[model samples]
Target: MSGRIVVGVDGSEPALKALKWAAAQAALTGDSLEVVTSWEYPASWSTMMPGVPTEFDPEQLAKEILNASLEKALDPATAAAARRTVVGGNPAQALVDTAKGATLLVVGDRGYSGFKAAVLGSVSTNVTQHAPCPVVVVRGESAAS
Candidate 1:
């Protein structure tokens, strides 16, 4: 691998699966793995949750999600070696941009597809479509299972 393996991570089962897979890939290829997560508040935040800052922080939540997923999904060694990235923005676009010089971009095929997801599209699909490097959508436990 020429560059890092950048993997999108959220507090979801599929995202955990992607993280595990990406960790394995990084281990085999001798590349560093980057665990990334992004979150955005509601568009009408001012009118919605007037106490936005005191109520919640998007960047902090993203960091928590990334850290939780890293601890839960990967082994101690892998989790310790991987870097964490937390940002506030569209998950898909954030991941795509992070893949600038990455060897590969990995994301999970979300199991839940709600109305908002249907409208905005999936992060995995968007990254696959926009990533400068190869993208892997981890759909299941194993490729040959």
Candidate 2:
């Protein structure tokens, strides 16, 4: 089954590593890579004293972030293997949902973490557990190197 591989990306280093890994995998397998990013309006900003003109648009933000991330992830020489997608929602949910039709789902082990954890981030852990297809969580400096 030669289907597209979906990768979850943010601006984090780990996400970039995952994207690079996915790109190589796509090139090796002759499959397309779908880079996905999720964005959402922070609840604090969206609910400023019961709707006081929230100037945040989650969809637009997602699109912009996804585009930027994809451009950074894709190489001009390997453009044929890359595609981009933006989904506005919880990051874990978006990756899991997109994983349904993908041959594989690739994600970062940790992303923009505030606290140190021994394991993967909540989003990566959740996607690994719930994704419909095979999931790969890229981590460590070696992956990037």
Judging by TM-score against the true structure, name the best candidate. 1
What digit string (tens of lDDT, one per residue) describes model 2 on residues 25-93? 987888788888888656776455466456656677677766666667667766444677788789999
> Which regions of candidate 1 fall more than 4 Å away from where they truly are?
46-53, 111-121, 140-145
Tens-place lDDT digits, model 1, residues 63-141: 8878899999988887998989887788888998888999999888773455332322377768878899998888743
Q: Candidate 1: which pairs clash?
A: none
Please name the candidate that would achieve the greatest lDDT relative to the true structure. Answer: 1
Q: Assess every candidate by TM-score.
A: 0.84, 0.82
Tell me how many clashing residue pairs each candidate has. 0, 0
The per-model lDDT (C-alpha) reads 0.82, 0.81
